[model samples]
Structures are given as structure tokens and as C-alpha cells.
Target: MAEKVRVGVLISGRGSNFVALEEWNRRGDRAYEIALVASNDPDARGLMAAKIFGLRIWAKSHKGMERAAFDMLMDAELRRHNVQVLALAGYMRLLSPEFIRAWEGRILNIHPSLLPAYKGLDTHRRAIEAGESFAGCSVHVVTEELDDGPVLAQAKLRIRPNETPEILAQRVLKEEHRIYPEALDTFCRTLRGEAQPTISSDLKK
Candidate 1:
């Protein structure tokens, strides 16, 4: 059996996507192990969810800490766990450029919208308002620029007329759950020097 790749996940909310990754790993393929789950918000539900999976959890309040200081703490924790890859699943905080440089290609993020468009908050709302025909999610490398990295995979859905942002968000979230794990698995495989699977950027509704 091959040694599992160690992974550290960062989350800010319910961590539905984090749960997806965890569940995927539990199926006995043993390609990767979720070594740690860390959150900036002590109250984040994801921390509790991580506990349910019997994974180690770390929480710190980022309210008053300087950006670099906070990120340094996170970096240290991840390193302590010997994490080879980091995944940002709705982690909310914008990482500093210094942190990005340190991790380089090792960090991955799943954004709620197609990249190079709706790069920031209110992504679903902005896409709806822009009269887009499609709205979806993108899993990509984490770079200094937010949501501007090379897309490894995407799950797209056609936008229905009269669709509210809330409704669209709920629908797109399902796709987010589906593709994030796939992208992360592919990423881990690449790190392990295994045969890389053909990953598609387009996932039809």
C-alpha cells in the first residue's frame, strides 16, 4: 500500500465541501488522508464536522490579529501536521501574497463562480444580474489574485430565467461538492507521481 498524502483543509462555514472530501477519502482508496482541519472562526460548524470525522481540528480568532500574523499561525499549524497539500473550502479569508508564495502550487480553492468573472463576494447575485446564461463553480490553484488561478475543473449549470441568487447558489453548491473532491483527488495523484487522470474543466448540468 502506498503512503497516503497528508492534506490540511481550511474552512469558514458549514464545510459542506470539506465533508464531501472527507467522505470521498473514507471509501478506502487511501490516496490521501485529511490530516487536519483548521478554521479562523471558532464558531464555524465545519470544526464540529471535522470532529465528527475524528480528524484533528484547530480554531483561532482572526478578528484582531494582523493578516501576516494570522497566516503565519495557520502556516505553522499546517506544517506541524506534515500537510503536503492545502484545500480552501469556503474559507472566506483572503490569503496574503506571502502565504501564497510559500505554498505556491500546493494550495487549491473552490470558488462559487466561473473564474475571471465574479471573482469576489456575491458571485451568484452578480452573475444573475449580469444576465448570464450559465453559473457554476471552479476548483483551481490558489494564487495571490483571488479566484484568478488556472482552473483544474469546473461544474457548470444553465441559469434559469427568474432565478434568484439564493436559488442559484443552492444549485451551484451541489456542483461545488461534486467537483471539488474530484479536483483535489487529481491534484493529490499528481503530487504522488501517479498516472494523472483526464480532468475536464467543463461539467454539464
Candidate 2:
């Protein structure tokens, strides 16, 4: 039998996507396991949610520790948990190059834009402000540069007229939850060896 893929989830917000992945795991179909959940913020609601689901949790505030040291701590926690896959649901900090290299293709992040497009914060606002015809999310490998890694899968949503940034954001978030787990599923089952990431557009233009 193949070893179950152990996963570590990193989040900075409510962790809706993380919750979705956990829920998906409980459905008894996936071969992945959420071994740990780590947050940079101690106050994240996801931390509480993770506890309710019986996941190990860790937090390290970024205010005082140097970047490298903080990453070392986070990396150590992931190692301790035997995390084979790292997923960033809403992690807000920029990871260092060393950390990225250490995990390499093992780490994944879900960004709220089509990527190579709106690559940073306020992605929803930027997409709406730019009057984009379509906007959605991308789950990609984490690299040193922000949102510049190779994308694994993407789901898109049409931008409607008179759509507020908040509304567009909500729509994008829905897609985020839908695709993150699906992307992981693909990675584990079909694309584990290929590693040839591509643009999957069942939901977008």
C-alpha cells in the first residue's frame, strides 16, 4: 500500500479552504491526511476550528523574530509532524527562499486571482478595478518570489457589472475552496510524477 500523504496547512485568516480540505478528508475518499495546522497569527479563527477537528496547531508571531528564524520554527513544526505536503490557505507572510527550497515542490498556496496577473494583496480589488472579464483563483507551488511559482490548477469566475470588491472576493473565495482540494487530489493521484503544472479551466475563461 502507498504511504498516506501527510499534509500541513498554514493559514492566516478564518481558514475556510483548510476547513474544506479537512471536510473532504473526512468523506473517506482521499488518501491525504491533514497532520497539522500552523498559523502565523495566534488569533486566527482557523486555529480554533482546527482544534475542534483535532488537528495539531502551532503559531509563531512574526513581529519580533527574524524572517529566517521564524521560518526555521515553522519548518521544524512541519518536520515534527512528518508533513509531506504543505498547503497555504491564507498565509499572509512572504516565506524566505531557504524555506521554499527546503520544501520545494511539496508546498502549495491558493491565491485569489488567475495568477501571473494579480499576484499580491488586494487581488480582488485589482481585478475588479481593472474591469477584468474573469477572475478566480490559482493553486500553485510556493517559490521565493511572491505568487510567481508554477500553477497547478485554476478555477475562474466571470466578473459581473456593478460587482463590489467584496462580492467579487466572495465569489473568488468560493472557487478557491472548490479548487484547492481538487488540485491536491490531482497532485497526489495523477500528477505526482508529472509535475508538469498546467492551467485547468473548468470554472474560468
Candidate 3:
């Protein structure tokens, strides 16, 4: 059997995506294991879920810390946990260039908008305002520039008429859950010298 890579997931909110990824990891034999769940918010509900899943969890609030300093702390902890890959699952903080460079190609993130589209927040609202026919999500490498990275996978959902951001988010989130796990697994396997397709897309009509 192929050895599983150690993946540390970072999250800031309720951790819906973290749950999705963990569930995917548990379903079968795969290329990666969610070794740690780290967050800037100690109160993140996802931590509780991670506990239930028996995943190593770490949290340190970033309220007063410098951005670069916090990223350094994260790096130390992830290294301590023997993490090989970092997955950003709603991790809100923008990493410093130092941290990005340290991780280099070993980090992956799932962004709400099909990347290179809405790089920042309010993606669903922005897409609706722009009259976009479809709103989507992307799993990509985490580069220094926000949401600017080589996309590994994407899932596009058709924008419904007059869809609210909340409703649209619910739809797009389902796809995020679907693609992120597959994308992360493929990336991990590729790094391990396996011949795997690195990019995939689901065009949801």
C-alpha cells in the first residue's frame, strides 16, 4: 500500500470544509491523512469536530500578533506535527511571503470563487452583481498573492436567477466539498511520484 502523506488543515470559521475533507480522508485508502487541524480561532466549532475525529488540533488566536509572526508560529506548529502538506480550509489570514516561500509548492487552498475570478471575499455577491452565468470554486496552490495560484481542480455551479449570496454559497459550498478532497489527494500523490491527473473540473449546470 502507498504511504499516506501527512496533511495539516488550517481553518478559521465553523469548519464545514474541514469536516468535508476529513470525511473524505476517512472513507477509503487514500494518499493523504489529515494529521492536524489548526486554527486562529480557539472557538472554531471545527475543532470540536476534529476532536471527535481523533485528529490532532491546535489553536492560537492572532488578535494582537503580527502577520508574519503568526505565520511563523503556524509553521513551527505544523512542523512539530510532522505535517507534509498544508490545506487551507477557510483559513482567513493572508500568509506572509516568508511562510508561503517556506511551504512553497506544499500548500493547497480551496477558494470560493473559481480562482483568478473573485480573489477576495464576497465572491457570490460579486458574481451575481456581475451577472455571471456560473459561480464556482477552485482548489489551488497557495501563493503569496491572494487566491492567485495554479488551479488543480474546479467545480462550477450555475448561478440561479436573483440568488442571494447565502443561498449561492450553500450551492457552491457543496461543490467545494466535492472537489477539495480529490484535488488534495491528487496533488499529494503527484508529489509522491505517482502518475495522477492533477487537474479536474465539474461543470455543474
Candidate 4:
């Protein structure tokens, strides 16, 4: 049997996507194993969820710290666990450029909107206000540019009539849970020198 890829997840709030990844690992996927769950917010509910699953957890307050310094702390924690792949699951902090250069293609983030569309927060609201017919979640390689990385996979849903942002968020989150694991699986396979799956759309021109 091949060794499982060591994955570290950085989260800020409820880790529904983290739970999905954990569930996938538990189902004998053998593609990756979550080695660490770290959060900047010590009170993040995701930490408690991770604890319930018996996964190693790290929590530190990033209040009033330099970006590089804070990211270095994250880097140290991930390295301490020998993590090979990092996933940002609802982690709100923008990673410093140094951190991005160090990790390069090894880091992944799941965003609540299609790329080149809504890059920052309030994605659902923006999409709804723009009268978009579809809103989805995107799993992409993390780059220095916020949500500007190459998209690996996306799961889209049609906008329901009169759908508010909160309602749309709830719907899109389910797709996030589904596609994130799929993207990670493909990413791990690529890391192992295997043939990459064709799940990704080309980088937005």
C-alpha cells in the first residue's frame, strides 16, 4: 500500500469542509491523511470538531502580528507535523508572499465563487446582486493573488429565485465539501507522479 499523503488544514470557523476531508480519509481512500488542523482563532469551532475526530490540532491567536511572522508560525507548525499538502478551508487570512513562494503549488484553497468573478469576501451576495444564473465553489491552487490561482475543480448550482446570500451560501457550501476532496485527491495523485485527472478548467485568461 502506498503511504498516505500528509495533509494540514488551516481553518477559521466551522470546518464543514474539513469534516468532509476527514470523512473521505476514513473511508479507506488511502490517498491522503489529515496530519494537522490548525487555526488562527483559538475559539474556532473547527478546532473542537477536529478534536472529536482525534486529529492533532494547533491553535494560536494571530492578533496584531506581522503577516510574515504569523505565517512563519503556521509554517513551523505544519513542518513540525511533516505535512506535505496544505489546504485552506475557510481560513480568512491572506498568506504572505513569502509563504506562497515557499509552498508554491503545494497549497490549495476552496473559495465560495468561481474564479475571476468574485475574488474576495461576500461572494454570494455579489453574485446574487449581479444576477448571476449560477453560483458555485471553486477549488484551486493557492497563489499570492487572492483566489486568483488556477482552478482545479468547481461545482456549480443554479440560483433559486429570490435566493438570499445566506441561503445561497448554505447551498454552495455543500458543493464545496464535495469538490474540495475531489480536487485534493487529484492534487495528491499529481504529487505522486501519477497521471493528473482533467478536472480543472484552464487558468482564467
Instruction: Pick the TM-score winner.
Output: 3
Quote the positional error of residue 132 for candidate 4 in Å. 1.0
Instruction: Please write out the lDDT profile of model 1 over residues 1-205, one tens digit for every residue.
Output: 6678899999999999999999988875846789999999999999989998999999999999999999999999999999999999889999988888999998999989888778889999999889999989988888888788788888888999899999999999988888888788888887788857454666565
**Model 3 error, position 47 (Å):** 0.4
- Per residue, candidate 2 scores C-alpha lDDT tens digits across 108-182 of 899988888999899888988887888988998888888988888888888888889998888888888888887
How much lDDT does each candidate structure score? 0.88, 0.86, 0.91, 0.87
Segments of candidate 3 deviating more than 4 angstroms: none
User: What's the count of clashing pairs in each model shown?
Assistant: 0, 0, 0, 0
- Local accuracy of candidate 3 as per-residue lDDT tens digits, 27-142: 98789998899999999888999999988999999999999999899899999989999999989888899999999989999999977899899999999999999989999998
Model 2: residues with Cα > 4 Å off, grouped in runs = 190-198
Compute each candidate's TM-score over C-alphas: 0.95, 0.93, 0.97, 0.94
Candidate 1 achieves a global lDDT of 0.88
Predicted structure 2: lDDT: 0.86
- Residue 34 Cα positional deviation in candidate 1, in Å, after optimal superposition: 0.5
lDDT leaderboard ranking = 3, 1, 4, 2
Candidate 4 overall lDDT versus native: 0.87
Rate residue 96 of model 1 by lDDT.
82
